[model samples]
Target: MSDSVEQQLSLFRYLIQTRSFGDSTLRFLDSLLVSKDVKSLVEIRSSLNQLLKSESLSIIQSITAESVHNKLIVLDFFVCAFAIVGDLESCLALRYEALVVRELKSATIQLLHVSPLEWLNFVEDAVKNGFHAVAVKACENALRCIGNSDVQKLGRDVISDNLKANTISEITRLRNFSLASITSRSVQVQATEYLERKTREQQKLDLPYKEKRCLASTSFRNGIKRQNMRKLYKRQTLLRANSEMQGQHPNLS
Candidate 1:
């Protein structure tokens, strides 16, 4: 391998091996990020993924806002690899993970730095995942947050016309849809509804597989046949429904 490639690999190795997010560690990471060479990009992403996967979800959730922001940067970089490879699902999941982390209030005002191309991919993926309403809102927020100046800096050619014009056009198109009302809600309300609906939809889709798996376990089989189990399931379902409703009506307990 060439000296530059070898050096990048070494830096990638160090990033994966180091647990600290101190100044020196970040500087090394920034060097690899600045390189932006596609030759070792996949390897870099893999290293990031390995490091992320090593941390438990609870630990990640408990980290400081700064730590979470740093992790978000890593996720954004890793997402770029998938985005470049045209891996739509992977891109969407990474974006979703970032969104969930943001919703959890792990950090405030920390941007994930998604490119226009990735934004388009995320919108497409959200539509395919039956969250088209969420997709439109995300686009609106992106344009709004990036504002008039930086959007131009991101690249004027991506939209053919101009970023401002194209962004307004896109938002208008998204707003014309029926689901735009959902986006009009407060951010917290919007996130809660979107998550609840998505979760229920997913559960519905997984019902058959879940049933099949349940049948294989003696405990599950016995529980399903018990009268008390039926009552418990019904009560749990009611509680979940009530919680979703309560989220919409903030005045309720």
Candidate 2:
């Protein structure tokens, strides 16, 4: 293999070993390899899946902060991989898993400090990729995180009120954007359905009229045929009467 390919493989191995999973990891991978490379994406996903599968059930069930954080990291990587592979369902599932893990009270805010920017990035990416539901879910989660958190609990000694306010503002804006997209999409679908239904109803309404017109045409043709038959019968009867009169008047001739 080429040196560049080897280097990418090395980096992938390091990422798997270190459990370093996030947007930066995805960016680095994209820089090294094509983002849409199915082979590379599948390889990374398989490795991550194996690692998760190898974990003990007991560890997963413990629900400690460390375990939750690690799980979130894996889930984040899974989401990124599934997204690149165009597996929207799996991507959304992993995102939801990450959100749920982050929401655990045992997952201390100090340890699992997901910034508003991170949430915004996820939401924006989801929206850009036509994952409005995922974007909306992310927005809701971000808002909930903000509402349930305080600057003091953020594990930052130098945090400010302004920072929290700004975070809230950003998340609210994202929420509104996602909601509007969903609403617009819903309205478009409803309008299309309405038009289709009306078209079908109009066709049904015109069917009887079409049948009536056909019946009227047939009746007119039948009436013309009956009138012609009567005229022919009258002409034949007059000719027969004339023949009888000629025979009876021969003696006078």
Q: Pick by lDDT: which candidate is best? A: 2
What is residue 78's positional error in candidate 2, in angstroms? 2.8
How do the residues 15-51 of candidate 1 rate in per-residue lDDT, one tens digit apiece? 6445443456545554554446675676655654444
What TM-score goes with each of the models? 0.33, 0.60
lDDT (tens digit, per residue) of candidate 2 on 163-195: 778777876777788789889999999999999
Task: Evaluate candidate 1 by giving its C-alpha RMSD to the native, one decimal.
Answer: 26.0
Best by TM-score: 2
Clashing pairs in 1: none
Where in model 1 is the C-alpha error above 4 Å?
1-56, 67-69, 73-117, 146-161, 178-253
In TM-score terms, candidate 1 sits at 0.33
User: lDDT (0-100) at residue 181 of candidate 1?
Assistant: 45
lDDT measured at residue 215 in model 2 versus the true structure, 0 to 100 = 99
For candidate 1, the clash count comes to: 0
